[model samples]
Target chain A: MAVYTEVTDEALAEFLTHYNIGSMVAFRGIAEGVENSNYALKTTQGDFILTLYEKRVDPADLPWFLGLMEHLAAHGLSCPLPVRARDGKNLNPLAGKIAAITTFLPGVWPRRVLVEHCEPLGAALARLHLTGEGFAPKRANALGPDAWNDLLQKSAPQADSVQAGLGRELDSMLHGIVANWPRGLPSGHIHADLFPDNVFFLDGEISGLIDFYFACTDIYAYDIAICLNAWCFEKDFSFNVTKSRALLRGYMAHRALSEAETAALPVLAQGAAMRFLLTRLYDWLNTPPGAMVTPKDPLDYYRRLRFHNAAKGAAAYGL
Target chain B: MAVYTEVTDEALAEFLTHYNIGSMVAFRGIAEGVENSNYALKTTQGDFILTLYEKRVDPADLPWFLGLMEHLAAHGLSCPLPVRARDGKNLNPLAGKIAAITTFLPGVWPRRVLVEHCEPLGAALARLHLTGEGFAPKRANALGPDAWNDLLQKSAPQADSVQAGLGRELDSMLHGIVANWPRGLPSGHIHADLFPDNVFFLDGEISGLIDFYFACTDIYAYDIAICLNAWCFEKDFSFNVTKSRALLRGYMAHRALSEAETAALPVLAQGAAMRFLLTRLYDWLNTPPGAMVTPKDPLDYYRRLRFHNAAKGAAAYGL
Candidate 1:
């Protein structure tokens, strides 16, 4: 783990003074994440999460994260509400890191997820997409196709070894995607990293969604593609069409996809697969030993990429 | 994107002093990564790469990264040789971050990989597995089954909403895999990441390999499984038995699998598929918007998981 900066108890206490919470209790040295240092903190008023800006998180991007949380909260989205600082600011500085406190959402992460949960999640995601309209942020999609090409170049020197074949495939795939790229879907603020850990549930209902760090402007359907990748697969890496339908139906209930968006689902799915495959590939190649962070298997994404390549239409997704 | 620490020209100059490389003539920032800051540096002596410990890299793990590089270089693996410090140490602190410089290998990443490449890659992977026999600096497999379970827990809350029957199916699959988990196979250090970008080629032959960060102690055949997932699939994600055969032949040429290992290959591939599916699922649920990282489609892995689940024997892989 990279401990770029540490928040001392005194510093945390002082920083908490600015918040509207009644009292402060802090847990420091939380897990090291790529984007933020998250501490589980408690206050007299309520439990909250204190996030220190890790090196990977740009200070300039803090407002977007904070504002998105506030926006989602304001729109009746079940999510953590950012607490204001003493100066009435949602963003604050603590221990040489940009910091913020958010109301802690309550729920245990599910031990075993069931098929029935997809509908609500799909609905919630659609709601999130709808709520993201008009959200003003300066940042753009970070992991778009151009960025993938650049990553390939960095790893290009080693491309011809046994695995070098993947580079070629990825290059061609990227070009294919670009040439046939879908244009002009409903674009909005997207929760780019809506992985399971970031979502909080109460009973069977989604009580809260957390971790808005990777949120950015992109095609709305792309988020659905992300969810399809996330929710419609079994443990053995098999696609469950039933699950795909449920998820898509759930989303459609809240916000219907345009004809173009529906048509682009398969291609979008392929792009999504390529995106992850490239990242996993990059991580697999560059991850150093003993970094504590695990690099995901590139083959996983490779398999997904291949599937998307073969997929004929969005009908497979029931979109 | 995350400049955890800036490396001054002087610091880079100091780094070059110990290496037998020539003058530092060029430095280019690689903008593709979400983890570290990499600069493609050219020295009068030869081309090299300078990697500054960025967000995801732990400073404490610098020695392990450096040592691994040195070890591989010593063994005639055509990888980057880390330049040691003036104190004869491979690890060193430069600027505010730990950094290392390594000799660059030669090769262009293939723009399109042919099925023929699989043989060399498979063979190279087998050689890598064999050579990893007693290499020191032990590390645990990062994303084994246990990690998959953990991700399941995290993503469980949204299970019902994301897929219709996926949660139940996933649960069943997990139970099945756990119950039928293979007992044993040749275990050793495995290059968990055998993706194409990490391999270097000269002409049609593999010249070298790079990126040992994800190397860990695990089942050797699992490494083969990873390679199969990476190399044997077509653009449309269908299994190519011909490619699979060539890859297996290459792998067998270097390190013949035990009967037990061969017998376990299909199941191992299933497990590999599941591992990827789970991670992709997790990423799908948690991706934040606007981040440069792309979330992969879970369905691709899901289908693969199903294929592996149905695969009854090693012959399925043309072995």
Candidate 2:
């Protein structure tokens, strides 16, 4: 529900003139992503998405994100294609903000995680990683292992406010996870935040993958681990092994995981849980009481982290 | 930017099954209109708007509003057409709330009012009033002059907090306007809230009129007075007589105003301004500081009230 910048009709009319897409038929700010201002723009040409990169996005990373989408789309992946303007560039300026238009993808993201949804989601994710090959621009995972300690240090003082002894417990867990972080395990482009809300499904099939702002270069299996935590957990914080087994089998069918990759799932899943927990904890402690967007409960991720910590090995994940 | 009720994907799919409007191709929550939850829904048939009536709207009035829109569209006025389901009824239930689908109208509302916009807007308002003749249902204006005094009494204690002496000044002005209120000047159904945002234009012509929640049975001249304050005023609170002239002239080209209606513009305009000021003042005082939608500044309407209070006659508005 972010529309930080308002584009006046007069300004919008002038802006569309520079594009080959037919004149604007309808345009509206969409309440979808949080980091950027998005509008569902319709023209005579077709429906498209217009995004104004807000302050949270770095203007420097614009090219890489747009280029990555192009790379994936060229390889026949179902993703949003950045609409190239008559100027031969996807990015353009409008209303004093860096804005771009993308072809509208057709599907609704699943709200409830179902067992049947796991296999198809797994295959699509693996295909995404395989298709992202040969894309030269590499964006190091910003929320990777190195950043966890810094996040922990900043949040340590007030972490107990979320849960008693959460600060010290996380400090020890962070040290262990960072020390045991794997050196290499088939790395490539990964959608770090592949939550159910980011993956769109239509008629029981994966139709589209969106919100590439968080896409970056990272361990491929780490992406799988993120999905394991996001997709396999039930509302009561219990891990569903049937969904986990299906998701893993779906991934292995597309691209087989190495013996080492399979073994690292437990630790990687723990680290993945840590990344979200730290961020959510920081937000929970910092967000103003009456803020527009309610901060998610950090304890939800903490419970997942506890499960990953107690798991003996990959078998615990039904791998 | 209101989406009070979130319609889940599973629920939405089952809900759309009742309608013959083809499968959903693309849908996104739209950040427009402050009242109901609106989604820009695109299906195989065509683009449409899905509105879930929130608690702010009375469920009993749903039929009248939908029927009025139907009547308007049936008369060849460019407005949203309520799409009927197989049951031949427009109203239906979805996600524990009443929901309906309406054919989407094409056109962008003017963000900045120009002189050229007033004439077409005037004609459209007249057409809307004239076309609404046979609609049998009658609804009283909820935010009429009668509501103004109650709102003022509720907001009086803190009115001076916004500006010195604003409470007492509004009290005396309210008495004068209420006592001098016009009666029976071409009374009919009126779109009580015809601000520029409610009127859409394309290629220098009015293409659509929307947000009929405030439409009610009232003096037609009072509707004109609302337009005078909304469309004919500059940002600095100075009246734009040029725009006002074109608006009234364009309106009368369809339906001529009687002598009494013309003479009543001064007090009527002041009353209209007071109506908005009181409501905005009440909202400003009641809404917490950090609410999602910022309450519109009551001072802006206060300035408009001051101008209307000093207006001598209809000639001052270029009538």
Candidate 3:
């Protein structure tokens, strides 16, 4: 477990006091991330996740993190709601770290999500985007292209000998993206990290969704591209057209896109490919020795990038 | 300007007592990045980057980060070399944050990269991998599919109702990758984040590389996939076959891949695609309101994913 910070049971109990979640019964580490500490807590009232903001999470961001949970929960999203404190605050300092308690949702993360699931997830994502329509918080994209550049600059010294060539290629790619970036797509709140684990299911139904730390305002089609990359590929890393169709069809079921949006899918997917490819590549090149975190394969996005390069039409995605 | 933790100059000066970089001439915030507090610093000896460890970075990982810099610098990689302190330490605590000083290289990030740059970057990357041959490290793939799933679980709750389908699709897609993950590929050190920003150049030649926080041991071909995604795409996020060939050829110049490795390119690219798609999709679905980070278009990878689905031969990439 990558428990960079330790939280005590007493500290958790004190934090839970702020939330009207009744009595706390049990608390245990979630045991899944290289960043932050999460505990699965079972309270006398119900099950909840207790997150102790670890080293990687900024204390200042806690309000947005917790408030987003409360806001989403209030807006009818089936998710863990942050428990409020006596002072009406969702965040509290504990054990010399910021902490919060959230209602534990019921359901299992599908290990074998099927095509049927894609439609609902897609629709739900669209609805989520709609719900965030009027949110007035002052935050910005936390890890956008600019941040990527900075991170790259920070680790350039260790980039081996190919740093120069890689630098040039990356610069060109970035410049190209900036030059031809799609404009006038429905820009609003987007769930930047809607992968499998964050989604929970009960008997083939999506019971809830979790995690919103990377959420920011960006293109809606970008979300669809992300789904395609995550859902459409086979284990051999080959894209599966059938899966792509399924995901797109599902997304379209709830949200109708304009012709411009539809036309942008291919290029949007390419940009999405670049985003992940850059992050993965950065992590791959900068993994510290003896760290517990695993660096993802950069090749996965490479093939996806190629596919976008060869892509000639968006109709194949049922757009 | 996302300075999660601030390091005062006094603290930096005290910390510099352990290094041979002489006295600090100047240090100021660089006014960029959503993670880490980066300052462009000038020492009595030369210009450098002083980074104050932010929320996302672990203090314990400082040594590995610094050591990797030292290792790469010794191996002829043009990157920031960590300046040792008077106490001969590469790391120091300043203003409640872990900090390090590195010799900054001179170069500008290219606005647009070309195929011509791909070859050198690829070759240099190959050489970097070769340099890692004797260095012993134990970091694994941190942001792989499994980690993606975990991140998804964390963010699913904040997904809007419309995005419900995305959650389902993502779950299914992850399961697909896990069930059908490819096999038989050479594994070694990889620069996970090879985005353009990390690479620096003088004129048209590569001068330096930076950022090693995400380096890890993974498939060598995966690195190629990452570079492809980073360098081979057009402004509209379309993959360019010509660019792909240029990148592969460049990579081949420095590291001659095995037949098995070459055979794995398409699949590796697919995996890379999925990895990026998943992360981008997740980010798209989870972007919170008013965040500084820009959400990347997920559709870009979707098209890329589709293209890989049709890829039956590796000849397209000049393998």
Query: Which is the leading candidate under TM-score?
Result: 2
Tens digits of per-residue lDDT, candidate 2, B1-319, equal 7566788788888888889999987778887887899988878899999999998799999999999999999999998999998889899999899999999988888878889899998999899999999898899988888888888999999999999999999999999999999887788899989998788777677879998988999999999999998998898888889999999998999999999999999998988889988888988889774455657888887788888878888889886
Q: Say which prediction, candidate 1 or candidate 2, comes out ahead on DockQ.
A: 2
- Across B24-87, the per-residue lDDT of candidate 3 in tens digits comes to 5534344344456666655667557777777666666667667777888898888788888777
Tell me the tens digit of each residue's lDDT in model 1 across A11-92: 6656767767865432423332456666556455645677778766768888887888898899889887888877889888
Residue B170 C-alpha lDDT in model 1: 82
Can you write out model 1's per-residue Cα lDDT over B77-181, one digit (the tens) per residue?
667788765677766667776677777665433334567688998888887776666477777777876676776777777765677878778878877776666
Top-scoring candidate (DockQ): 2
TM-score ranking from best candidate downward? 2, 1, 3
Model 1 residue B288 CA deviation in Å = 31
Please report the interface RMSD of model 2 to 1 decimal: 2.4
10 residues in a row with least lDDT, candidate 3 chain B: B1-10
- The positional error of residue A286 in candidate 2, measured at the CA in angstroms, is 4.5
DockQ of 2: 0.50
Q: Which has the better TM-score: candidate 2, or candidate 3?
A: 2
- By summed lDDT, the worst window of 10 consecutive residues in model 3 chain A runs over A25-34
Predicted complex 3: CAPRI docking category: incorrect
Give all candidates' CA lDDT scores: 0.71, 0.89, 0.68
Candidate 1 TM-score over all chains jointly: 0.49
**Fnat per candidate:** 0.00, 0.50, 0.00
Displacement of residue B64 (Cα, Å) in model 3 is 44
